[model samples]
Target: MTLLICAFAAIIATVKWYKDAPEGNMKLGILCWMYWGASIMWLVDAIFEYAELKAEYFTPAPADMLNDAFLGLAVVALGLIIWLVWLLIKDPRGVVKAALIRKKA
Candidate 1:
């Protein structure tokens, strides 16, 4: 479930980044890398768990499935939050700088 969620996010981010390739924004690329890395991590986790559980891995308990879904959503939200903070710090478009300068007047 985590792999699925992160893969989806990575795909979306990659597409968005590609569309804005001319802008050469680092934030978008970072977001894509983060999600893709997470997806790969989850994939490896899933593989090892599958090896341990064998056939049983296919039938996860409903509660476990729900928990995994919530965890996946939380991770995605956290990634977005981190990206927002980075964007604010970078102030790529200078909105924050402009606001601060205006306040000095």
Candidate 2:
């Protein structure tokens, strides 16, 4: 299940990178941020589940732990996806400018 989640994430990251490659570095940066955010979320959830299993005398059922981890990751991923979509809506051009361009001539 973890592997499947990771694989889907990898595909999203790849597509985002490829989309940004030709246009602007900002898209790449945002996509990378989104990817890392997702990865970190899952990593933290896994650690927590690991600790939970270790602390209990009875090991958590595989299905239970897996469900918890999947739930946590899905929540985090959903938040990030929403934010990414918001960013896209806000910046339809997909460019991040350090400074606004002005007509001097």
Candidate 3:
């Protein structure tokens, strides 16, 4: 479930990054990297668990599945938060700077 969720996010982020390739001002590339990295990590974890559990690996308990879903959502949310913080700090279009200057005036 974790792998599935992350792979979806990675795909979506990658596509968005490609579409925005010309301008490249949103710092979306960072988001793509983060999602891909998470997907790879989950893939590796699934592989090791499968090797250990063999046939039983497919049958996860209901509670475990729920936990994995929550964790995946949390990870996606964290990635977005980080990206937003980066965008605010960079102020690529000078929006934040302009707002601050206006407030001072």
The best candidate by TM-score is: 3
Q: What lDDT is obtained when candidate 1 is compared to the true structure? A: 0.88
lDDT of the candidates, in the order given: 0.88, 0.61, 0.90
For residues 1-105, what per-residue lDDT tens digits would candidate 2 score against the true structure?
453465466567667777767765434455455656666676787678667776562465798768956875775477468657766556656353323555477
Q: Which stretches of candidate 1 lie over 4 Å from their true place?
A: 24-26, 103-105
Residue clash pairs of candidate 2: none
> Candidate 3 — worst ten consecutive residues by lDDT sum?
96-105
Cα lDDT for residue 15, model 3? 95
Q: Write the per-residue lDDT of candidate 1 for residues 1-105, one digit (tens) a residue.
A: 767888899999999999989786557877998999999988999999999999999899999988988888999999998899998899888888998886644
| Candidate 3 TM-score over all chains jointly | 0.92
Provide the TM-score for each candidate, comma-separated.
0.91, 0.44, 0.92
Ranking by TM-score: 3, 1, 2
lDDT of 3 at 67: 96
- Per-residue lDDT tens digits for candidate 3, residues 1-105, read 878888898899999999988887998988999999989988999999999999888999999999998988888899999999999999999999998886634
User: Which runs in model 3 stand beyond 4 Å of their true positions?
Assistant: 103-105
